[model samples]
Structure formats: structure tokens, C-alpha cells
Target: MSLRIVPVSFHEACSFVDEWHRHHRAPQGHKFSIGAANEADELVGVAIIGRPVARPLDDRLTLEVTRMATNGTPNACSLLYGAAWRAAKALGYRRLVTYLQAEESGVSLRAVQWKIVAHLPPRRGWSTGCRPRTARGTDNVARTRWEARIAT
Candidate 1:
């Protein structure tokens, strides 16, 4: 399978994600989006990179893979992960981070040399009396945080 990296508009990437993602819909926004295309020029996977959702992790030097979805193409996730990091590093980001559902195996991350940085326990939705928000279906599902850092 010849996979090549391609630039994708956020809206186009989100549309592919909506059609293929298992647990979540497309994220609200991204700094950039990358796509993996086969020899036929069909996009098979996408990675949405953006500022970290958690305030503490929103340091200027860090960016997060807000969402990644693929059409089950072999090696597509690993390719996207690697491409995203290279793009982020080229833009002067020191670190790239992402999260996986706890039940998911970190095969793609491991392939790209992303380290397990933290195991995040599930919480009630981010909603608070001070900032009301809708509870998402992922409310009770734990997640694992992973990181790929540029060598200093």
C-alpha cells in the first residue's frame, strides 16, 4: 500500500471523520489537518492538530492531535501520526500529544515512537455550574495520554 501525506482542509477532513470515526465526531477546530492518500488519491485517514484542550497542556510549545480517524487502511494511522509530528516540529512545536481510549492498543503510537505520558481517569463531563456544557457520551470512559517530543 503506497501511502502518501496530503494536505486536507479542515472541513473535508471532518467530513471523512464523521463518516468513519468510531466514538467521536469531528473536533470543533484545528490548526491544521493532514490526510493519508493511497495511490488512487483517495483520502483514507486524517489527523486534526490543534491547541491542547486542557488548559494546563496549552503551553505555546505544545500542540495536540485533537482527533484521528481512518478507514482501516493498513499503516494509515502510523503514517498520519508520523506526518503530524513532523509538521508540528517544522512549525516549531516542541511536543505533540494525543489521547486514546483506554481500551485501545497503542500500536500506532508505538510505531511512531510516541511515549505514554499519563493515564487519565474518566470524569464527569467538563460542564460546571459556572460553564454549562452538554455531557458527551465519552463521559465515563478512561483515556491514555501519549506524547511525541522533538529531541532538544
Candidate 2:
């Protein structure tokens, strides 16, 4: 089956992620979003791009794939990742990044030439006595951060 990129509103993208993401909920906000559709014009995947979660990395020139979800479509995830980077670059962004649970093989990322640049240790949920938050963390698992290379 073939796939194509389609324009997706943030709300639509979030809704897709909320329904299909394996272990996380939709993000709070995004700079933009992309959709992958099948020949029938049905949305099969989505990728939400937003500011970097790490405050220090929120350099305006950089954008992050805050979330991605697919209905188990082959190559859909990789296509969305590649499309997200191209879209970001077209909008004049210098970098596109994403974080994934360490257990994830990142085959999709590797297929598109995105390389792991950092390893983030597991963390307790972003909660504290001063500002208690929900425990919907990444299951307290470590993560690997990836970045797309500049195309030649």
C-alpha cells in the first residue's frame, strides 16, 4: 500500500495521537502537524511538531516531533518522521528532533537517516509537592533523542 502526506490541523492530529499512540497521550500544543493518508484518503498516521520539551533546546531554529501515531501501517511512522523534517526545513527551521523510549528500535528513524544524539535517563513523573502532576510519564523508562541530518 502507498501513502501520501496531507495537511492536518493540530486538533485532528492530536485526536489521532490520543487514539493511537502506544504509550503516551496527545501533547499540549504544537507548531504544526502532518498527516499520512492511504489511497482512500483516510488518515492513517500523524506527527505533531512543536517546541523542544527541553527548555535549553527551544532555540527557535529547532523543532521537535512532539508526538506521532499510526494505525499499524507499514512505513507510515518513517514516512511521517521524514515528512516532519522536510516540512520543518521548508519553514526555515534548522533542526528537527524526536525522543523515543530506549526500548524502541528506532528502525523508522534510522531508515530516514535520523541519528541518536543523546540518551536521557528515566525520570519520575513531572510531579512535585509544590506542583504535583499526573503520573503519565514514559513509564519511567530511559529515552533516546534523535536528530535528522541536513540533506545534501
Candidate 3:
């Protein structure tokens, strides 16, 4: 599929989520304020900016990049992320925040030249039948919060 990011409607975003979940089982009902379309005009990624979960600091919305994916292109994730960020800025969001799996591709970050404003300390929270969990807790929250606050 050729590469290009396009905005998708809520229904289309839900369909993308369904397809993503088919390959990777994640929570349903992901909310995305914007989406990405490829060169083929196919939806490949989605982004959403939500109201601050903890507080509504000075009318700023939290740009929560809930989900992002690419069919196969190396730079597709970046395209999606850039488009999403631009969209967020267009919508008057002052900050953007997202959580990504270390193992997953960091194409989006690289594409946007996203800096690591902060990082969370390693944590030890294990799941019921899963292997050891990744780090968690205060450090992570602090870093994420900081990034959200600083991202423009």
C-alpha cells in the first residue's frame, strides 16, 4: 500500500480498531479524534486527544495517541503520528501524550523527532498468567506527565 495518512470518521476508526484487535487482542472502544490513511487511501492509524484524566489544567486537552499502526511501510507510522500531531495542534490541544511498548516499532517517534522529555523507572507488576511485567509506577507517570505537558 502506498503511504499517506488521512483522517477517518469515528465509525471508520472503530473498524480499524477491530482489525487491529484481530491481530492483537487489546481493549475495545478506543477513542480517536483523528486517523491516518495510506497512499492507497486506506486507514492505517488513529489518534485521539482526550480531556485530561486527572485534571483540566487551563483548558488544555491531553493528546492521547491511543493507537497507531501501518500495514508494512517503514515510515508509515511516522506519517500517521505527524498527521495526528498536526491535527491535535489544529484542534487547539497544547499537549500530546502516548504510551508505547518498548518492543514495538518507534517509527512514529523517529518520524516526528520526538524527544524523550522524561522516562519512568522500572517496575515489577506481574499479570495473572503472564511473564514478568515491564517497569511501572511513579517514575513512569511523572515522565509521561512531563512529556504531555512539554509536547507542543
Candidate 4:
């Protein structure tokens, strides 16, 4: 089935992610968002791009695919990943990155040419004695960081 990549508002994308994503909830915010629509014009997926959650990677030159969710539509994710990278480059960003839970295969990302850059160890939920916070439910899970450089 043919798919179209279209601009999506942050709110709309967040709503889609919340409804369809399996591993995590919608992100706190995003720099921008994109959607994948089927030939019939139904939204099948969304990608939320934002500043890197890790403070070390939060420099102006980099952006992250904070969340991506789909209604099990084949190729929807691959399309979103490619579109997100292209949009980032056009907007003058040098690098685009995203993290995947350890259990997730990076096939979709690989199909779009993103590389696995690092494997991060698991962390306790973001809550600490000093700064208590409710867990978003993904703490203690290992993650793999993937990245693609914007071609000049």
C-alpha cells in the first residue's frame, strides 16, 4: 500500500502515540511531528522529534525521534524515519538520533540507513530519593541509541 508522509501537530501526534504505542507513553513535548497516512488518507503512524532526552546530547545541532507509533502498518515506520531525517537536515540540524528498547529490532531504522551507535545500560526509574517522580514505566530497561548524520 502507498503511504504519504505529512506534517502533524505535536498535539495530534501525541494523541496518536498514546493510543497506539505499546512500549511507552507520549513524550513530554517535541520540536515537531510527522504522520504517515494510507492511500485512503487514514493516519497510520506518527513520529515525534525533539531535543535529546539525555542532557549530553541536547546541543542545538542534534534532534531525537522521541517517539514513534503505528497501527501495525508495514512501511509506515520506515517512511517516518526517512522523512524525519530529511526534515531535520532541511531545517539545518547536523544529526538525528533515537533510542530503542533493547528488545526491539532495529530493522525499520536499518531499512532507512540509521546506525546503532551505542548500547546503554539499564537505569533505575528516573525517581530518586532526593527528587521523587512518578515513573513513565520504562525505567530499568536497557536502550540502544541509533543515529544518522544529515548529509550535507
Q: Pick the candidate with the highest lDDT.
A: 1
Tens digit per residue, CA lDDT, model 4, 33-131: 999999999999999999998899989999999999999999999999999999999999999999999999999999999999999999988888898
Runs of candidate 2 exceeding 4 Å displacement: 137-139
Q: What lDDT would each prediction earn against the true structure?
A: 0.95, 0.92, 0.53, 0.94
Residue pairs in collision within model 1: none
Query: For model 2, what is the alpha-carbon lDDT of residue 25?
Result: 92
RMSD to the true structure for each prediction, in A, is 0.9, 1.6, 6.4, 1.4
Q: What is the number of residue pairs that collide in model 4?
A: 0
Tens-digit lDDT track of model 1 for 1-152: 89999999999999998999998889999999999999999999999999999999999999999999999999999999999999999999999999999999999999999999999999877788999988768888899999999787
TM-score order, best first, reads 1, 4, 2, 3
Rank by lDDT (best first): 1, 4, 2, 3
Compared with the true structure, what per-residue lDDT tens digits does model 3 show for residues 39-122?
667666655444443344425555566555445546666766676667666777766666554444454576686655545544
Q: Is candidate 3 or candidate 4 better by TM-score?
A: 4
Q: What's the lDDT for candidate 2?
A: 0.92
Candidate 2: RMSD to truth: 1.6
The true-versus-predicted C-alpha distance at residue 145 of model 1, in Å, is: 0.4
Number of backbone clashes in candidate 2: 0
Instruction: Please identify which of the two predictions, 1 or 2, would achieve the higher TM-score against the true structure.
Output: 1
